[model samples]
Target: MAELEAQAPTPERGLAVRGLRLAFGDTVVQHDVSFYVAPASIFVIMGVSGCGKSTLLRHIIDLQRSAVGDISFDGQRLVNAEPARRAALQRRIGVLFQSTALWSSMTVGENVALPMQLHTHMRAGEIRDQVAFKLALVGLAGQEQRMPSELSGGMAKRAGLARAIALDPDYLFLDEPSAGLDPITSQRLDALIMRMRDALGLSVIAVSHELPSIFTIADDSIYLDNQSKTAIAHGNPRHLVEHAEDARVRAFLKREPIDEPARATTNEY
Candidate 1:
């Protein structure tokens, strides 16, 4: 594992977002968004649908170039870093997309080993050993040969998580990690996330609107507002719910749908 450990980042630190602005052609998603993800902490990005939560995530992972602002990981600028530098930064992080993003054609073990095969000079035997270790960590041990189609939703999410951490990244990004999961399964996943943070000291950034999951796992959070075109609230989800000055933030936490159309009714004269 020395080769894998050799690629790890030195002097652990957190992620910082400053003055971030994102747009696509004529439409702007978010602007002037700023927040900090503490080292080894689980920070959540949350908002209603189309509120640019994912867009902000894309910017952080360098999937989409931000129209303005800067993002730094461990003190290195990510916005305009050199290609080599960007690639190096990428090696220190891992992302689990909303869809799990596993290849249907590949077995679970193969899916997890793919990244190592692409990025490292690790021997096949070593890769196999690491793959097994990660799968075990995620509670998916001995299911390496199972296809994506063969696993349940919870199993698949766990498998995807294993794949994300195969390289032992210092930072992990998850997009709606509990989407479509049952409450029990979601809670289990949240627990796994906590274990990862506590045990590995990995900083995690998650985008989720599941209140239970968010409150269960988030150490900090940033809420993007579509109307404001920027972050409107930032803090622990529970703290924000209880004391945030924004009505919308409180409404969201209360599970009151803010935009539901009023029902039509005939009044008796």
Candidate 2:
């Protein structure tokens, strides 16, 4: 136990969730959920549809409050933190919703520049340069004037990603990033995600059940079970598929039949 403790990554400089419970009015979504996201790592939240995967992402990014427990970033409290403090912390975080959510009325460049325009005193020239740089990073260079409607599904997703990283945030939150993308496009996006993580040192928390995306990008992951209303597994996705003791976890990862009864157990590999 002492050796294991000594070898564990410290949560001081990363995202940490302790006994988190989420609810909507009288209904509970999840309970006793706990996990740690080490800095510069890609962590995935994965489960079947309607398993509250996206809801958990919402809680992490402060869109919805957890009914119990706490969420912290770099040792600073995010849950129940003062508004000013929370805003300051959130400025270092960027989010890309499942739909991408780019403003249809704006050009791709305008969408990318909006965050800096609203949040920083960077001059127009500076914002423009930053916008170009971000767009180029996402392989959308020289296409800034294009509107969202003109872009293909893959191109639109990339454009949205450019906007998400506009401020060069330390943490990136992505909800269903590959939802409507083709296999090839999804693979390219996965590669881009890894490259950005390496280049920017971002700690990414993504909600995805896409097997290919989850296996390709996740350094670690947590499986949220809707029936149990809690997390049942945590570890590297590749490792969990074969080594997970829980039948449900292995079944989910390997895309096999889950004939075993649902047993609530938070096992970390």
Query: Highest TM-score: which candidate?
Result: 2
Best-matching candidate per lDDT: 2
Q: Tell how far residue 30 is off in model 2, in angstroms.
A: 0.6
Model 1 stretches astray by more than 4 angstroms? 1-12, 259-269
* Candidate 2 accuracy as lDDT: 0.88
Model 1: lDDT to the true structure: 0.87
On residues 1-269, what C-alpha lDDT tens digit does candidate 2 reach at each position?
Answer: 32333234446799988777778777787888889999999999998777788888888899888647778899887867899999999999999988999999999999999999999999999999999999999999998999999999999989989999998899999999999999999999999999999999999999998999999999999999877889999999999999987778888998887664564663221
Alpha carbon lDDT at 106, candidate 2: 97
Q: List the residue pairs that clash in candidate 1.
A: none
For residue 162, give model 2's deviation from the true position in Å.
0.8
TM-score of 2: 0.92
